[model samples]
Target: MKNKILVLGSLTLLSASLLVMNSCNSLPKGLKTIQDFDKNKYLGSWYEIARLDFVFEKNLNNTTAEYSLNEDGSIKVVNRGYNFIKNKYVASTGKVKFAGDSNEGKLKVSFFGPFYSGYNIIALDSDYKYALVAGESLKYLWLLSREKTMPNNIKETYLKTAKDLGYNTSELIWVKHN
Candidate 1:
């Protein structure tokens, strides 16, 4: 009986430790979240100007993301897009929490329960009109803007930055807002 109780306690402790470790995820190597990121300013809506082809967003166009504060202080994410091939609209809701410090742009977003992925904001304009976001690896990158269209200069600059970070900028798919 005592041996069984000890084993249970050990398992409980190990489970708790794993939970803690998962909650404290870090950004991918060679990527850094922006400093002094204000979540409040980042809230509201953003248009997906460009992105690398990812399964969740494949064949999607006219994509936009809405962010709001959840009751538990996590960011509520609503991603909506039009599937041109399917001729239908699709959306997925998720939650985002700071991976580390709240002031940094490093966050983990989960659409599936208890399974989080990195959402690191690598760059942003002072007015929060445009942002460059990186996922867990070079495979996932997004260029977002407050409006449907992004400026030429900003697009060029962000593409250069992504390329510098070892991303294949040529593979980027420019999202159509119409």
Candidate 2:
């Protein structure tokens, strides 16, 4: 009887996990991601151009994210920034993996163990020099570039896309680079 209960509980837990993970895939209609994303070409450093304020990144500047391939086939994520409030630099390391078997643009990133969040590359430049990323919702969005800054035209283009996707573009905090 005990063994039967244990197996049943295990199956319940697995079902719940799947439900929670699927919830993170809720995206607005007409919001499309880049196609044929090459993970290898995207492995590098990206400067944060703009983002919506979040606790982990609040009061930060000169923010950057670096991605590299791990031997285990996961992506190593390194996020760094200067904390003006703390008057120091802060960095966090994380891991990322594709959410689907063959979709390189949709990823799940985890900083705290076993707690994953969506990391979708909704828009990207052909040369992989610029990208617009979104989380599970419109509340989590970021604009990234290979350089410290991006051209006005590119910024406007991304902003328009975000606006079209029902995001509040005015709430984006433009990141400062030093």
Q: After superposition, how far is residue 89 of candidate 1 from its true place, in Å?
A: 0.2
Candidate that scores best on lDDT: 1
Candidate 1: clashing residue pairs, number: 0
Compose the digit string of candidate 1's lDDT tens values, residues 101-148.
899999989998887888999999999999999988788899999999
Show where candidate 2 strays beyond 4 Å: 1-23, 101-103
Model 2 weakest lDDT span, ten residues long: 21-30
Where is model 1 more than 4 Å wrong at Cα?
Answer: 1-24
Tell me the TM-score of each prediction against the true structure.
Answer: 0.86, 0.86
The weakest ten consecutive residues by lDDT in model 1 span 20-29
Q: Write model 2 residue lDDT over 34-137, tens digit each, in one string.
A: 77988999999999999999999999999999999999989999999999999999999999988764455887898887778888898999999999998888
lDDT of 2 at 71: 99
Candidate 2 displacement at residue 42 in angstroms: 0.3
